[model samples]
Each structure stands twice: as C-alpha cells, then as structure tokens.
Target: MPGLNVLAGDLLNVMRFYTRLPLPVFRFEREAHALPDFRRAAWAIPVTGAVVGACGALAGGLAYLAGLSPLIAAALALAMQVAITGAFHEDGLADSCDGLFGGASRERRLEIMKDSRIGTFGGAGLFFALLLRVLALAELFRLMGPAALVLLPGIAALSRAVALMPVLLLPPAGSQGLAASVPLPGLPAWLLATGIGAIIHAVACLWLDLPLGGLVSGGLALMLMPALAALARRKIGGHNGDILGGCQQVAEIALLLALSSAANWRGPL
Candidate 1:
C-alpha cells in the first residue's frame, strides 16, 4: 500500500509539472522530486510533449469517429489544450507576434506581449495560426486514414519537445512565470531523452507510411519553431513563457502539415 501511494504521488507530481493543475501539496509535493528547476525544465519538455500529444490523439480519434472533417479534429485537439491550460500558449503566441512584429524596440516588443490587450498583429497572427492548423489537420485526416489518430499524439509530443530546444539554449526574458520555476537540465540528460523521444516519434511516422512531403513539411514546421524562437530571442532580447507556448503551437501545425503531405504522397512510408 505504501509503495502504491508513493508511485501515485510521483505520477501526480509529474502531472502537475506538465499540466496546468495545481496538485494538493501533501498529495504530490516533494521538493526533491519537483520538476527540474526552471533553468533545467528542458528535461520536462519531452514529458509535457507526450501528455499534450496523448490528448491530441484522443481528441483526434473522437473527431474521426464522429465523422467530422480533419479540420474539426485538428480544431478539437487545439480546443482540448485551451481547456486544459487556459490557452496559456495560444495567448503567448499571439502576444509574441504582436510585440515582436508590431513594436520598434525590444522593450516595446516585450511590453506589447505583456499587455493583456490584443493588437492587430496579435489578432492576425492568431487567425492565421489557427487557420493553418485546421487546414493542415484536414489534409492529414484525408491522407493518413485512421492511423492518424494515433500518430497525432506522437507529433504533438515531438512539437513540444522541439519548443524546449530553444528554451534550453536561450535565456529567459523574464524572471517570473512558470519558466522561472523550471530548472535547466543537463545537456546529456536532455539529449538522451530527446533522442529517445525523437526515435519514438519517427518510428510512429514511419509506421504510418506517411509521405515524404508530409514528413518534410512536418519536419520543416518543427524547424521553423526554433527559428522563430531565435528571432524572438534576438528581437525581444530573450524568451518568456508566452513565447515558448507560441513555439509549441506553431510546431504542431507544421508537423501536421508535413505528415499530411507525406501520407498523400506515399501512403505512410
């Protein structure tokens, strides 16, 4: 009984770290077992990736079973995250775009992202990002058949993992928020986990016989995220929690597009 209790507590700690829920302290607290410090939170990236991905897979499956379009499935997946995390990331993506592109200086950019108010850039960015995702998902649905439901989660995990790459490599723009609490994980640890996660995602993609086109598109989407992060770092001078979230959202859309294309071109290779 004690052993089971300990395992449950550890799982809760992991859940709290990955999701938006605040666990009851006694139920899941362990200062030593808490997520790696903010600096090393990169280690938790893959874990978070898997959780979000699992959610996406579930939602995507339901969407398919309901005979809904791929776009609906994709949107449903997005909706699930918004429900779970309070749109924390979607908000970040919008804010980062508004501030970075709309402002003249790093300070201004950061200030813009911080404001709860939405600007033209932010609104437009959100619209386009959501649209891209919907369209990409629809395309993927048409191409991948039912296996897409399973593959979607793997892609989600990979996208989140991709977002962590930037966080691990760059300094935070602010000293607060969840990122502040996350610790920098060791390079060796991060690399090993990331490699394993990548292998799993890749194996899943290959199993689906996804087309080269989809793979390229999806891989490009993942690559674009870090590039955006690099740009955000340079333009805004550093990363914030919001920017990190934006990267995850963008990467997921890109992956869906790539995988969709691959499925159409090669029928899951």
Candidate 2:
C-alpha cells in the first residue's frame, strides 16, 4: 500500500498539472523528481477532478443559497470552474474543433491546433459547448436543487477518468508537446483511476437515490469516451493533451445534458 505522504505527493502533482491552484512548492528532492512523471501519477487524475468539481459545486451551492435563480447559479458555477482551471479544457475543445474542421490535411489540422488563434469553427464550437453545459446545469439545478452538488462532482470525476482512455489507447499525434513528454499510463493505473471515479459516482447515486434517468445519463457518458477516442484517432492519427481535454469536455456536456433532461422528466430529487 502507498503511504499517506506518497498519496499526498501524487495528489499535489496532479493539482499542479491539472489546475491553477496555488499549491505550495515541494522542497523535497524526491518529490520534485516524482512530480513531472505523469505516467506514474495518472491514477490521481480522478482525485484532481474531484477537487475541481468540489470547488465548482461549492460556488454553485453558495449562489443557489443566496437566492439566485437556478440559471444564474449554474452559470456562476461554470464560470468559477473556468476561472479556476484557466479554461484549460475549453481551450482544448476549441483547438480540437478548429483543427478537426478547419483544415484540409492532417498536417494542416495539426498546425491549426497548435496555433493560438481561434478560427470560426473554434469560436462556434466553444459557443455551443458552453451553451450546452449551461443549459444542462440549469435544468439540473431546477430539478435537484442543492442535490446538484453531489452530481456535478461525480460527473467531473467520471469525465476526467474517461479522458485517460485516449492516452492509454492512442499514440501521440505529434513528436512534441504534452503528449510526447508524458509516458502513457499502464493498465493498472487506468484501472485504479476508473475504480476511483466509479466508486465516487456510484456512492453518490446510491446515497442520493438518483432516478433511472440519472443512471442512464452517467452510463451514456461512459460509453461516449471510446467513440470519442476512435474519432480522434481517425481524424488526427492519435491523442494529445488537447484531445484529452476535448474528451473531458465532451463527456461532461453529454452527462449534464442527460442528467438535466432526466431531471426535467422526473421532477425534483
């Protein structure tokens, strides 16, 4: 079994990589060495997602408690999440859109993705993605009220966990950037991450006594990951940080939409 210190270090490393949190610098030489190797620490991704999700949930809950409308509360939650993460995943989604649709060749697509400028396709993608998330979240808030706190974090964890699939299954699309630097995590790491996400979500579902619609939404999100990975491979050859980020965004939106639609049908939890 891993010691608490080891787990803590892994969690810190994950946070440093995944979020904009101002975590304290690790002074230990061993910790520093361990920090950059994402392959060994990939299992901590779900834990990182949980932290991000918790922050979003807290912001949304607070806004809801302040008597804001559900729509406003949901928007605040998403804004807070984007602010916390520096819009990292959303940026990837835009890049993926621009590259996948804007370019005529694989090389051209890769170049488009690498560029910082957002094109028409990228802008439209971001607009639609944000709109879908906001609408789904608003519906969830309307049905579940504060119960959305539990559901959002679960969805976040699951989305990140699913994002790992691309890294594990596909080669890097390019010879440089984040995908090339980090080694792909092995099966054990993937299993550990998946288990953590599943348990977190399953517990939330059981504790909340979520309806059949909620379960269906979660299940569909999980199913979408592989299809997304396949599409990425077919389009650009393989996966990258941008691809993984796009996967997470896609999964989150799908889950939220399903949950929100279900909530509308089933009424409040």
Candidate 3:
C-alpha cells in the first residue's frame, strides 16, 4: 500500500482526469496534469464519483428543502453533475451511439466515433438518456424526499467503479485512442475499486435503512454491464474509453430505475 501522500496524489490525478475542476497542481507530483495512471488511481475513481454525486445532491437537496418541486430539484442536481464533469461521460455516450448504430462496418463505426460530430442516433440517445436520468431522479425524490440523497452518491461511486469492467473484459479497440494508449487497469486495480464500491454500498444501505432494497437496486445495476460489454464486443470487437463511459451511463440509469422501483413498490393487492 502507498503512503497517505501517494494515495492523495492518486486521488488528485483521478479527479483531474474525471472532471473539469481546477485542482491545485502539485509540483512534486509527476503526473498531476497528465493522464492518470488509472491502475493506481482506480481505487480513487469511486471516491471522486462519490464526491461528484454528493456535490450534486447537496445542490438538489437544498433546492428541495427550499420548497422547489422535485422535478426542478432533480434537474438542478443533474445540472450540477454536468457542470462538474463537463459532461465527460455524456459526450462519450453520444459518440458511442453514433459509432455503434450509424456505421455498418466496424472500421466505419470507429471512424464515425472519432469524427467529433453528432449524428441522428447520437442526438436521440443523448436526449433520451438525459431525460430518463432526470425523470428517475425526480421519481426517487418524490418518493423518498431528502432521504433519496443517500443513494445517489453511493450509486454514482459504484457505477463509475463498475464501468471499469469493460476495460478488464475486452481488449483495446485499436492501437490508437485511450483504450490503447493508457495502460488498462488490471484485476488488482479493479478489486481495489470494487472494495471501495462495496463500502459505499454498505454505507448507503445503512443510511437509507434499506439493506435489501440497496442490494436489489445495486444488483440490477451490476447486471446491466455484461449485456453492454457483449454489445461492445460485437460492435467494435473491443472496448474503449467511450464504451466505458457508456457503461457508466447505463449503470447509473439501471441503478436509478431499480431504486425507483423499490421506492414505488406498494406490495401485492
């Protein structure tokens, strides 16, 4: 294990890569401004995810307490998240969609994804995904009020951590792009991340006072990734940063909907 300072540097590196926040660059840290060594930083990704979600929830929680409608509050929360992340995963989702659906051939699909231009499929997928996320957050807020805040951070943490699964499961799509350039996180990195995710999950369960419900919702979210991994494998023969982002989006959506369902369950009539 690294010393406290090394871990702190790793956390800072992950946060720098994951968001647009202007963090203080440490002169002593070798990779402060460069792409993170994700293997070392993988454990910190969930921590940063939790921080991002908590910041958003704080904004939304305040809005709800200020008497805003749940819908408005949910929107505000998501907006904060976007502002923080610069829609990093969202951009990846759009590109992945354009590449996955617009191009018939694998090479063409990868080319389209690299074009940096949005197409019909990309636009619609981004729109609906954002809509679904906002609506799901609203539903959770409507049902659980401020208590809903507990789920978002932990689930966000878990989703980001699990998003790394595709990295472990597939090869880089090509010799270019991030999947190929950066060293992919190995099993040990992923295990560290998963351990952090489990802690976050347990804390969320305790806070929400719903151990079974957390497991149910979080479990469904976990189940969603394998299908996504398979799709990526078929479409492009491997994974990339964009596919990993798509995985995060899918996991977040799955967890939100599952948690919403748990909140809405009213028992058999």
The most accurate candidate by lDDT is 3
Model 1 per-residue lDDT tens digits across residues 1-269: 23655545544555565567555667344562566453334444555566766776688788878998777887797677666656666787888788888999887887787799989988998899888777776666676655666665566666666666666667888776666676645566556546655655777766665445445755685568668878977897677777877887887777766666666666532
Give the residue spans of candidate 1 off by over 4 A. Answer: 1-11, 21-28, 31-43, 211-222, 267-269
Winner by TM-score? 3
TM-score of each predicted structure versus truth: 0.81, 0.93, 0.95
The lowest-lDDT stretch of 10 consecutive residues in candidate 1 is 36-45
Which residue segments of model 2 deviate by more than 4 Å?
26-29, 32-35
Backbone clashes, each candidate: 26, 0, 0
Name the 10 consecutive residues with the lowest summed lDDT in model 2: 27-36
| Candidates by TM-score, descending order | 3, 2, 1
Taking all chains together, the TM-score of candidate 1 against the true structure is 0.81
lDDT of every predicted structure (CA atoms): 0.68, 0.81, 0.85
lDDT score for residue 184 of model 1: 48
Candidate 3 runs further than 4 Å off: 266-269
Model 2 over residues 29-50: C-alpha lDDT tens digits?
Answer: 2564344455667778888888
